[model samples]
Target: MGFAGAMVVAMAVDALLGWPSKLFARIGHPVTWLGGLIAAIDAGWNRESDPPALRRAAGIAGALLVIALAVALGWLLQSLLPPSWIGIVLAGILAWPLVALRSLYDHVAAVANPLLGGDITAARAAVSRIVGRDPAALDEAGIARAAIESLAENASDGIVAPVFWGALFGLPGIFGYKAINTLDSMIGHRNERHEAFGWAAARIDDVANFVPARLTGFLFVLLARKRSEALSCMTRDARRHRSPNAGWPEAAMAGALGVRLSGPRIYHGSITDEPWLNGGARDPLAADIGEGLTVYRRAMLLLAGLLAILACA
Candidate 1:
């Protein structure tokens, strides 16, 4: 099937059926099982290699194997169940676990609530729930900036990227994307410990996200009018960020929201001087995070619309 058709099928299934049948709840659902299985494999296979090259190879091999397994298992499920509504219903239910809209909103809401309540301590704690940074020193603005940054960055990684892949290759592509993404999340760090060990996951994720991130920027521009500047900002600033891919969405979001993002952030007690994007606008505010949510919603709708058009065309 074409991209459009696959997306329609996937989204329709997700919207109507949602995730995880009670029947499978005892096993913690298929998505959880797949993630757990990959995590287990990574735990063992990752230890078998330590040199940068070996570790990188192990990570890639592990990612590919997990994807293959997901595909094989999906096929097995297809066969075990008859091709009536049961097969289609089961597929939709299982697929819902792969998407992450509800989870993302919940995480961001946790951070925003504390900020709205004027509790800096609680706000910082909430920020810590979503970010790995030291939150104690962050002021209201800093916390707002961090939460918005994650919302923008993850809109691509956690939401659009998976949907894009899933639309193209159905269960297998989504499964592969999630496997690589999970590996990246776990090991794709720049710290000394993960710099070598996670290099493969990091690089593969970079490539994997390269298109989706840029597309996210484009969709943002298409949705927000005043944010039209996002197109130019994305073109210019995306390449400037440390990660070859992440800056596209961050820069696009910064421009869309008319604020700066990603400059001089602290990680693991040390400070890394990162350049700012869209410095011409106001510092981001709690309200801008709301704007970010609107943008996220538009992007997802645009994604679904694009898929529908593709399916029909």
Candidate 2:
């Protein structure tokens, strides 16, 4: 199947080049394009005046439209390519901007370096770019926990999930998945404006990510030094999270690193009292963020290796 080959090519290209700043400045990235589309749809269709049921129905229609458009565009592009190995390579290159491999590394490393230098100020500033929590309230342990959790969860969201879909149905699959994810990120929340309007987006995102999230957790468990600990923690604590899919990777990372994560934090001026994963373990420090990144790297490499093996077979 072209699934393995196409995803491998996309991952390799993204790792090597990282969608250079110059190129991004000129044309922006594909995800940004998707975001813009989602924003436009949200603004137009999701009316606050509408009843809850009407808003929900509109939201569902909007989501289906975006997904259909993305899949259609993907099919059109894929069809224009030469029907050979070159087509697969080209598809991967086109898919490169969709994968956020290098960006994830750079983002987590930004938090870790400043944190290791004892610059809590700068570390908090860096972490705010990736996490939604109130950065000012975060001390060293809080900062480390937020960054590590973001890294582990995003490892599934930003990388593995896309690759998993790409590996299953090639271009159209990946494109449709991204559409669902972007819609969820844009409007899928419990706030007054989005609670009803974003229900379908959230539910679809959960279903789409269910398998990929567990696979990402499994990859982390396989690469972690404390393999049994990671497995036990994941099996024990994954379902307790607020998000149906995110807990798998976060719990696995917490158990693998022998640290606790996801206790409680401030979001939008209110405290969300989340239960901890690996709650008995010590709090994670800056060094553990680096260790988390190391495991992330190994898991990604292992995924690539498996893809290569499958491609050859």
Candidate 3:
């Protein structure tokens, strides 16, 4: 019953009016709530004193608990709605805060605007909010690359993936995905303490993002001005980047803009010697970030259009 249409509403609302500050001040975001839960579970279950095998098991149990709680809340909310057109609208409104469509665009634009003004200091500050790398080390070219890469990668995780699931499974889908994603972000790292314990969270995140990531890449390819190059680069270079999911969209963006991305970079004082996507291409300029935003908007439109078609069907 208009599942696709509900997603369309969620997209439209979020794009027009992002999560308002007043509302956020009053009630913290769903992710923050989930994050609190994850933190508690991590402190309690992910013990440094525990053996690695038992820590792994505890992580699994903790992950399951978080997922179950989110899924259950979503199910309960969905059950409260009457099954009608009104319910569809309500469903979309509830899912609105989950998608970060406008937030991603605005964040990348924040970098572009300052860089365009030739304020390297301001640009560096803007980009640092979004990327994990050391901003102080970045020149204009580095800032541009970081911002565009963030735009492309988060376009999948922040927008398309949630929309894909929400359209298919309503509240349960979006909520469950956010919970998984948040857990991964918080605990899924190869640090000494979390390497074994966070294994389950990392693996689950990978599996969840697999299809949405490719779909996001395809969307970029379909609408890119340099369509053929985008396709070729995505196919040839996606695997070259570090992440299985992030590389698809990031490579496609690199090809679409005719700019190289994902070469070596410093993260927290250490160099991550990542392979480049479209390595032969020139590095991105500040203006390329603006161009990347245009492409991003187009790809999102194409996604919304497809969902609209399905809704009419």
Candidate 4:
């Protein structure tokens, strides 16, 4: 079986079983393991008083070490299996944890379910798990907006990007990409402790995600009911957001749902006046989050279909 075939099987398994809770309780998720390594590096090396250049160098070294380890682990797994169909199945099993389609949907649903039930506090608490923003201060609209934004961004990072790399370079590629993403999540920020130190990790993540992010936006446009509006928002507003890669799916999502996103918001008690995508659109409601999930589901299905076709070809 080819890499694309393995990807299809892995995605199906993820959609159906979603990292079984029993298994996870016994042996945590891949990201959790990766996080431990990243945290250790940060604690050991990311000193607040270190010179900016030295800190940056240390961060880069740590990121490189993590990437090498991930790749080596992937290679070791693949090497253990005979080069046959069984190897492909084992590869799919190993690759399954790296993709987050089911987990992402579940997390978003956790927020939407509470909001739909009219429990604002529960909604805020659910959204806090997926976002860094201050959740206690959020209203219903704020909670809904945060959930939708996180869904869009993570759909790209947690789903499409992994599939893209897995299809191209098999297990090693996907694991390496996950390492980059994990490093960024742990240390990539503009805060005083991370600004200089995390520069390399942030930039590396941006580069790794560049193509996959755009592909996710294209999938969103295809699935969106308002295709023209989604495309227009992607073209006009994607570059306006802070990150080079995040805005693509976010803009498409904003236009698809006809709800504005990425406006002024509080993060860790600081308010950032970010540019709004689809600025004139309506503020998101609980129903809008449901609509966004519909779009995300369709887009994921479309991606699976495409991968299957390529595998067949």
Least well predicted 10-residue stretch by lDDT in candidate 1 = 1-10
lDDT of 3 by residue, 183-254 (tens): 999999999988988999999999989999999999999989999999999999999877889999999999
Q: What lDDT does each candidate get?
A: 0.74, 0.93, 0.93, 0.92
Query: How do the candidates rank by lDDT, highest first?
Result: 2, 3, 4, 1
Mark the regions of model 2 whose C-alpha exceeds 4 Å error after superposition: none
Candidate 2: residue pairs that collide: none
Query: Where does candidate 3 have its weakest 10-residue lDDT segment?
Result: 1-10
Error of 2 at 90 (Å): 0.3
Worst 10 residues of 2 by lDDT: 1-10
Residue pairs with colliding backbones in model 1 are none
Candidate 2 at 48: error in angstroms?
1.1
Q: Name the candidate, 1 or 4, with the larger TM-score value.
A: 4
The TM-scores, one per candidate, come to 0.85, 0.99, 0.98, 0.97
- Candidate 1 to truth, TM: 0.85
* Order of models, best TM-score first: 2, 3, 4, 1
